[model samples]
Target: NNFIPFYFFVDVYHEGLQYYVIRSIGGNLILLLPVGLLFPLLFKKLNNVKRILLTGFFISLFIELAQLSISVYIRSVYRSFDVDDLILNTLGTVIGYWLFFILSMFYKRVTYRFKSNTSINIE
Candidate 1:
């Protein structure tokens, strides 16, 4: 039910609820970090940042919608939908993608250097 993005951040800041801020923001961001790192590595088609972004957005949207559905079905607000979660989750995915990219680059550079150094000449 929290459609306003970053609203929780403002509320938590004003109320000095540091724990909620960390739990909500950090939890959402960390939730999808693995998705970003693994999707591209596992699927050749997801080897780009754009694909990661869209995938993250849709995944987060589905989670939020599911929560809303469960809350309605149970006649209780077990979890509320929040746009900020979508934003933060997507950001986390992008960050993960960048980390993967950097690591891949470093790996390639190291392997290439090792191969060149270990080249054997045929007589």
Candidate 2:
């Protein structure tokens, strides 16, 4: 909490565009994708969009806060806590949820078709 928070997109605006894209934006998104995909799978209650999104937001917020804590208390600047990272991480989770939903639908359809074909009629 003692760490200074950047309210604006200073990192992306002032830093190298390529670095921001590759490390900050894309990295955070990719890093949190598994959290999004697995949360609903592991916990049925999170299958809903609102719950999943909230969980994602809290998880990212926790990570950012933890990073800030380490920097402030432990005297380490291993990471930078930024709100943009939080937003991007949440978006990544949403994308993963959609990916899981699409894959699940495809799996259900294929299994249903297979069962329909294999089941025998007791005529």
The most accurate candidate by lDDT is 1
lDDT of 2 by residue, 1-123 (tens): 223333344555566565655666678788788877888889999997788888889999999988888888978786767777788889899888888888889999999999999998898
What does candidate 1 score on TM?
Answer: 0.94
C-alpha-based local distance difference test score of model 2: 0.79
Q: Write the per-residue lDDT of candidate 1 for residues 1-123, one digit (tens) a residue.
A: 889888879987889888888888888888898888889999989899999999999999999999999999999999988899989999889888888899899999999999999999999
Per-candidate RMSD, Å: 1.1, 3.1
For each candidate, give its TM-score against the true structure. Answer: 0.94, 0.82
- Give the residue spans of candidate 2 off by over 4 A: 1-16, 121-123
Off by over 4 Å in 1: none
lDDT against the true structure, each candidate: 0.90, 0.79
